[model samples]
Target: MHLQKDTNPALNTVTAYGDDYIEINKTRHQRSIYFTPEGQIYDLGIQSPFDFTTELLQKITGVCAAAKSPMDFLDHAAPRFENPEQIEVLLIGTGKTQQLLPPELLHELLNARVGVEVMDSQAAARTYNILMSEGRRVVAALII
Candidate 1:
């Protein structure tokens, strides 16, 4: 969506861009945000009384956000194979470029023993789709 100057002062103009796969927008909060098929943005002022960023990641990964202590979003995105010996990788999208994740969260994931890789949102989505089509249970979070 293109950002246009609104005549109504109450309405803020949000600029959005994307193709068939994903969309990124400059929200009213002035933060560049990403969207998922679940119809939820990464940070869009949802009141849940919890860390919404963490919760969104869990939801996108199809894991029970309440199950574990802040379930590893990456691991949830890329689920474990039926055979424990099989290795899985999670592709996390942080936007136009790979952004740093919360250090504490990263440490937690590493401690839980899951393979994690961070990439830009577009690349992450593409890679995830490729892996899944190849009969891999990989998950991706596209920011935008």
Candidate 2:
């Protein structure tokens, strides 16, 4: 991991493999994304306000709502899929509180042959980039 200062204060100064990660001095808003070379944001292309609602908000919320515990949001989010490896990392973001994912959900994923890795949304984003850079198949849900 490498860090580089950026001229733009709104952008993250740290660069991992020449990609931006953290952003400073700006209001944190929802639906905002920072991209990395390894991870191309996956747009499931779900339809309507449903897409934005789920991809941007509901998914995160659902994970938290289901967990009923304070855990890192990434713990609930979907996992990343890498080559030859079936384990997936799910990034759950807790906007203002700590939360945990329900055990049943994790089990469901595993039953489907997907490995689960949980992290906060920010870490998930960064990890997504890293996975993408590594040339893994990543699927993300986004509003059209």
Winning model by TM-score: 1
TM-score of 1: 0.44
**TM value for model 2:** 0.37
Per-residue lDDT tens digits for candidate 1, residues 26-144, read: 44333334333224445434322123254454443443322343566746654331323232555676666677676554443343344557776556656654564465545444444
Tens-digit lDDT track of model 2 for 1-144: 333333234333224321222332232223434322333333233333222332233232222222333454648855331223232443433222224555654554444344344444445545554554455543222121
Count of backbone collisions in candidate 1: 3
Candidate 1: RMSD to truth: 12.0
Candidate 2, poorest ten consecutive residues by summed lDDT: 17-26
RMSD of each: 12.0, 13.1
Q: Which number leads on lDDT?
A: 1
lDDT of 1 at 48: 23
